[model samples]
Target: MNDHDAAGPSPSPEHHPDGVPKFDRRMLESLVCPRTQQVLIYDADAQELISRAAHLAYPIRNGIPVMLVDEAREID
Candidate 1:
């Protein structure tokens, strides 16, 4: 079999080469601040997911979005 067939299923959403998470509309809408349940804004320029209410921004590294609270960076 070819490599495609051997590979079976596609890669996970967190492992894209572009360093941007492949978030569907539903998923994006569902992602709220764990602490405040506030909406998040997608910052393409910064390549991060920002929660303004929480003053937190999650980074996307090598196409993988770091969603952990501890891994997020504080924004001004």
Candidate 2:
């Protein structure tokens, strides 16, 4: 087999290595703000989960979400 066949498709600007999408959308479907218990808006570019009700943005690092008030950033 050729290297191209083994490697499969090259990583796109949007995806990570090993053919895994950065942060699965389906998982976020059930994610909610810990404080307000409200739905969160996923920010793909910023890699954050925004909680409008709480006016906070939770950071997601290495495909894992950091869902902590202390770690969240206050938003306007």
Candidate 3:
């Protein structure tokens, strides 16, 4: 079986298929904050996504990103 089949179907960010950065879709449906599993909001001004429920902010490094909890910034 292919690796994808083993992992089941998941809507991964739209990459170049050749493993290159192209576009991302996680920004649209990633609602659960990785830290606290809370709701998240996109902060276009800061170019960083915020999780008010978790009181943390995840950065969009470069162009592609996965806002995992460990990499998130704590809010004041």
Best by TM-score: 2
Best by lDDT: 2
Q: Which residue ranges in model 2 land beyond 4 Å of their true spot?
A: 1-14, 17-21
Model 1: lDDT equals: 0.73
lDDT for 31 in candidate 2 is 90
Off by over 4 Å in 3: 1-26
Candidate 1 has what TM-score? Answer: 0.60
Q: lDDT tens string, model 3, 25-56?
A: 46548556767777667664455678888888
Task: Return the candidate ranking by TM-score, descending.
Answer: 2, 1, 3
On residues 1-76, what C-alpha lDDT tens digit does candidate 1 reach at each position? 9999998999666534655565443556767766678888877667678889889998766544677889899999
- Considering only N, C-alpha and C atoms within 3 Å, which residue pairs clash in candidate 2? none
Clashes of each: 1, 0, 0
Local accuracy of candidate 2 as per-residue lDDT tens digits, 1-76: 9988999988753456554358777879889999999999999888899999999999987777889999999998
- Which model, 2 or 3, shows the larger lDDT? 2
lDDT of 1 at 13: 65
Residue 58 in candidate 3, Cα distance off native in Å: 0.3
